[model samples]
Target: MARVMRDATVAATAEKIFAACGPSWLGDSYNHWSAAVKAWAVGATRSLPDDDRRAIVYKTQELDDALMAARRALEEEDDE
Candidate 1:
């Protein structure tokens, strides 16, 4: 039963995540799964426990930070 519940959760998460990826960003290698997963994490689950929400938020921040770094690096390359 626990296994079945876990599988259901995974399926639901995947569906929610799939709904998140859209309006395509420029110059991105669109991996639908990654975007969907991120969206699922930051979406309706906002009502989860503080620790869970915080973890998701932190993950989002980390991804944002990485993207900013990548963009800066690209800009520097363009300048050179």
Candidate 2:
């Protein structure tokens, strides 16, 4: 379904963000990259109408989940 595909895209984007942010020590205040990415993602979707914006709530959650997974994977890689 289209919704599923869209969620997948959102997740992939979050994963990339996690990987890209892993190398930088952006300070404690800036450590919440997942949240920052979600905020950015949501804002990026603001051009959509109210209903469409509402539709991506689940997509945002998917992005958050993917971000966490990516973070763990990166940490494990560093441990290797």
Model 1 lDDT tens row, 1-80: 11222434544444433334322233453343344455555656344444443343344344444666788899999999
Instruction: Report the lDDT tens digits of candidate 2 across residue range 1-80.
Output: 12333655655655565455443333332336535554655657444443333344344445555556788899999999
Q: Name the Cα RMSD for model 2.
A: 7.4
Candidate 2: where is the Cα deviation over 4 Å?
A: 1-54
Stretches of candidate 1 exceeding 4 Å from the true structure: 1-47
Alpha carbon lDDT at 18, candidate 1:
33
TM-scores of the candidates in the order shown:
0.45, 0.33
* lDDT, candidate 2, at 5: 34
